[model samples]
Target: MIFAIIIGMSLATMIPRVIPAFIVDKLQFREWVNRWLNAIPYAALGALIFPGVTTVKPDEPHIGLIGGIVAIILAYIGLNVILVVIGAIAAVFLLSI
Candidate 1:
C-alpha cells in the first residue's frame, strides 16, 4: 500500500541523518564533502522565489518585491516560523486590497 511505501521511505530518510554520526565514528575522512551540500538551501530558496516574483495573481504580490522583501527580512531576523508565515499572509492580504 502507499502507506507502507511512505513509512519505508520515512525510515530510510531518518536513518541516513542519524547513521552518519555512528558510521563516521567508525571511519575517518580527510577530504571535504561536495559543496552542493551547502548550496541546496539557498538554491531551494531561489527556486521558491523565482516564479512567485515573476507571476502575479490578483491577490498575490510579486515574489522578491515589497512583501517578499519584507518576508526575507523577517526571516533573516530569525522570527518564529509560525509568526513568519502569519506575517507573510498579513502582508499579502493588506497589499491585495
Candidate 2:
C-alpha cells in the first residue's frame, strides 16, 4: 500500500545516514583524521557555494561576484551564517538594482 511504500522509502533514506553515525561513534579517529573531518563541512560549503556564486545572476555575474565576495568576507570575520546570507542577498539585490 501507499503507507508501506512511504515507510520503506523513509527507512531507505535514513538507514544509510544513521548507520554511519552509529558505526563511526564506536571507532576512535586519529588527530589527523579528526582535523580532516572538521574541515569537510567548510570544504563542502565552498564547493556548493562557488558554482552558485558564478551563476546567481546569469544576466550580470558582477552582481553575484560582489555578493559572494561580501559573503566570504563576512564569513571570514566569523559573522553568523544567517547574517552572512542576508548580507549577501541584500548586496546582490542592491547591486542588481
Candidate 3:
C-alpha cells in the first residue's frame, strides 16, 4: 500500500509536465485550441479565487484576493507591476487587520 501510494504521487507529479512535453511534439491542436489555451490561467485563477471570494464573511474574507483583483486590473491597463503588487499587499494587510 505504501509503495502504491508513493507511485501514485510520483505519477501525479510527473504526468502534468510529461504530458505536455510528450504531446506537444507528437500532436497539433487546432487554432481554436490555441486560443482556449490562452485562457487557461484565467480559468485557474477563477477556480481558486471564486471559492475564497464567495465563502468567507465580509468582515474576515480573503482581503488579499480583493486587492489582487484591483492590482490585476491596473496591471492589465499597463501600470507598473512592482508598484501594483506592493499596493495590493498593502491594501490586503491593512484591510484584513
Candidate 4:
C-alpha cells in the first residue's frame, strides 16, 4: 500500500513536469523571449539569496551587507566565482570576529 501510494505521488509530480518539456521542445521562442528565459535562473537565484544575505546576523545586519558588497566588487572585477564567494565569506568572518 505504501509503495503504491509513493508510485502514484511520483507519477503525479512527474507528469506535469515531463509534459511541459515535451510540449515546449517543438516550440520556437523569439530571440528576446529566449534571452529572458535564459536570465530567469540568475534572477531567481538573486531573489532567493538576497534575503539570506541580509539576515546573516539579526542584530548586525551590516555585516551581511558588507559581505554582499565584497562579493559584488569581486564579481565586478571579474574575479573567479569561487574567489568571489570566498572573499565574501572571509569578509563576513572577519567582521564577526
User: How do the predictions measure up, each by TM-score?
Assistant: 0.51, 0.63, 0.59, 0.64
In terms of lDDT, the best-performing candidate is 4
Per-prediction tally of clashes: 1, 0, 0, 0
Candidate 4 on 1-97: residue-level lDDT in tens? 9999999999999999899688898889999999999999999999987878889898888899999999999999999999999999999999989
Residue 53 lDDT in candidate 2 = 80
Q: Which stretches of candidate 2 lie over 4 Å from their true place?
A: 1-13, 75-80
Model 4 is weakest, by summed lDDT over 10 consecutive residues, at 48-57
Cα-based lDDT at residue 76, candidate 1: 90
Report lDDT per candidate. Answer: 0.73, 0.90, 0.78, 0.93
- Tens-digit lDDT string for candidate 3 (1-97): 9999999999999989788877788878899998899999999988887766634346655564678687888788888989888877777777767
lDDT at residue 12 of model 3 (Cα atoms): 93
- List runs of model 3 lying over 4 Å from the truth: 1-11, 53-59, 72-77
User: Which candidate comes out best when scored by TM-score?
Assistant: 4
lDDT of each residue in 13-61, candidate 1, tens digit only: 9998998778867765444644665677999989988766645463544
Comparison by lDDT, 2 against 3, better one = 2
Off by over 4 Å in 4: 1-19, 26-35
Name the 10 consecutive residues with the lowest summed lDDT in model 2.
48-57
